[model samples]
Target: MIILGIDPGIADTGFGVISAEKSTFKAITYGTIKTSKADDLAKRLDYLYKDIEKLIKKHKPSKIGIESIFFAKNAKTAITIAHARGICLLAAQQAKAQIHEYTPLQIKQALTGYGAADKNQIQQMVKTILNLKEIPKPDDAADALACAICCAQTKQYV
Candidate 1:
């Protein structure tokens, strides 16, 4: 199965694509969609929407896995991220892909066998699972990959 994972943000949205069969995983693509702070919030969301649409078109993933919005200290920041996430969901819907949402704890648990695992641990697991030369970059990208890995693991158990 080909899965597209998303770590949503207004400034730097992360995306990862992976093909998984049983316990095997192949990393297809991983990157961040960056928007300038100079741009308006609406424009940043538009950029995210367009970029995600392009990714869905290019890869034609069977499903999309996205990080669920976690409460942050800053309410404004959370709201902004929520907006971006909404657009991301819309993009997946438009692409006609099955969507699944996972929490950060769930992703870490799936990848590293520890619900409280740190970022480094999760990234290391992602690299090892995919047999990559290096950890996926830009933190957000790694998180996105972790989400995809979480979905793959969940599918296996189910």
Candidate 2:
């Protein structure tokens, strides 16, 4: 199955696409969607919506795995991310893709067997899981790949 994973952010939304069979994952593509702070919030969200929609149309993923929102230190920042996340959920729904949301801790634990695993540890696991030469780039894309790996392990396609 082609699984599309997303780590949503207002400024830089990370996305990764991978093919999964049972527990094995092979990376297809990974990148970030950057939005300008100079643009209005609505325009930024619209850009995200359009870009994500394009990705779905391009990849035709069977399902989507998204990182769920957790408590953030900055309330305003959290709210901003929630907006981006909302657009992602909306896009998946509109595409008729099965959606699964995972918490950061759940993703870490699934990949590393430890919920408290740090970013480097989780990225290392992602690298190993996908059999990549290095951790996926730009941190956020690696995080999205990790979320996909978690769902690939925990969720059964059949």
Candidate 3:
């Protein structure tokens, strides 16, 4: 099965694509989608949507694992992230892929066996689990890979 994982953000959305069969997993691709703050919100979202749609069309992943928004002290920031996340969801839906949502805590625990694991810990685990020579560049991309691994480990898919 091919799975795509997304870590959504207004400025940078991270994406990781992996192929899984039984207990084996392989990283197909991973990267970040960047948008400048200089652009208007509508334009940024449109760009994000189009890029994500292109990814779906190219990879044709059967399932998508997306991190759910965690509300911070800043409500405005959370709302912006929600908008980016919604674009990701819309792209997945348009592609007719099964969507799976995982909270930050769930992803961390699944990846590092600790809900409060730090970013470094999660990144290390992602590299080790994927058997990569180096940790995926950009923290967001590693987080996205963690999401994919988490979804694959879930009983629903197993």
Candidate 4:
């Protein structure tokens, strides 16, 4: 099964594509879609939606896993993230992909067996699980991969 994972943000949205079969996982691609802060919110969201839609079209993933907002530093930050996440969901829905939402705690616990796992732990787990030569870079990409792994590890998929 092809699965797409997303770590959404207004400035840099991370994405990972994986093919999962039983207990095996192969990384198809992973990267970040970046938007310039110089642009206004509307422009940035437009760019985000278009890029995400392109990814969905290219991958044709059967399932999409997205990170849900668990905590935010401020109301503004939470609102912005909600906007970005909404775009992600819309893109997934438009593609008719089965969407699964995971909170940060859920993703961390799924990957590391501990809900309080640190970033480095999750990154290492993502690398080790996929047997990648090195950790997925830029932090966000790793987090997206972790989300994918979590989704894939779910009993329904396994």
Candidate 5:
């Protein structure tokens, strides 16, 4: 199964693609979609939408796993992230891929066997699970890959 995982944000949306077979997961591609700071919020979102659509078309993933929105102390940041996440979900729906959502706690637990695992612990697990030399760059991209790993791990039980 090919799974695309997304960690959405207005400025830097993270994306990771992985292929899973027989309980083994391999990272295909991972990166961040960055929008210029000079661009307005609407323009940034438009860029994100188009880029995500292209990514979906190119990868043709069987499913998409995205991190659920976690409440933030800054309501404005949370609202903006919610909008970005909505567009990502829409892109997955349009591509007709099965969509799965996981929380940060769930992803950490799946990857590290600890629900309250720190970011470094999760990154280390992601690196070890995929047999990569180092953690993927940009914390968001690592988190996105972790989300994909979580989905791959839970697929059998679900």
Candidate 6:
């Protein structure tokens, strides 16, 4: 089964694709969609919407795992990220992918068995779980993979 994971941000939306078979997961492709800060919020959102749709078309994932809004230091930052997340959700729905949301705590616990695991710990766990030679870069991508792993580890996939 193929699962697409997303770590949404207005400026950098991270995406990771993983193929899961039974207890093992294979890393597929992962990257971030970056939008310029110069772009207005509306334009950025539209860009994200189109880009996410294109990604769904290209990957044809069976499921989507997205990180939910968690504690943020800045309200504006959180709201902007939420906009990007909404686009991801719309793309997933349009592509008929089963959508699941996990909080940062849930993702952390699922990947590292510690709900309060730090970013470095989660990244290392993501690397270890996917059996990759190196940790996925750009942090966002690694987080996305962690989201995918969280989804895969839960309830049996049909």
The 0-to-1 C-alpha lDDT of every candidate, in the order given, reads 0.92, 0.92, 0.92, 0.94, 0.91, 0.91
Error of 5 at 115 (Å): 0.7
User: Largest lDDT belongs to which candidate?
Assistant: 4
lDDT of 5 by residue, 1-158 (tens): 89899999998999999999987889999999999999998899889999999989999998899998867779999999998999999999999998899989989899988999999999999899988999999988998999989888885444
In order of lDDT, best first, we have 4, 2, 3, 1, 6, 5
Decoy 6 TM-score against native: 0.95
Per-residue lDDT tens digits of candidate 4, residues 71-133? 999999999999999999999999999999999999999998999999999999999999999
Task: Judge candidate 1 at residue 83 and give its lDDT.
Answer: 94
Tell me each candidate's TM-score: 0.96, 0.96, 0.96, 0.97, 0.96, 0.95
**Cand. 1 TM to true fold:** 0.96
Query: Tens digits of per-residue lDDT for model 6 on 12-85?
Result: 88999999999999999998999989989999988988988988888898989999998778998788778888
lDDT of 2 by residue, 97-143 (tens): 98999999999999999999999999999899889998889999999
Q: Higher-lDDT candidate among 1 and 5?
A: 1
Name the best candidate (by TM-score): 4
lDDT: worst 10-residue window of model 2 = 149-158
Query: Candidate 5's C-alpha lDDT?
Result: 0.91
- The deviation in Å at residue 99 for candidate 3 is 0.2
lDDT per residue for candidate 1 within 1-158, as digits (tens), equals 89999999998999999999988999999999999999999888888999999999999999899999867879998999899999999999999998999989889888888898988899999999999999999999999999988887886433
For every model shown, the clashing-pair count is 0, 0, 0, 0, 0, 0
Off by over 4 Å in 2: 156-158
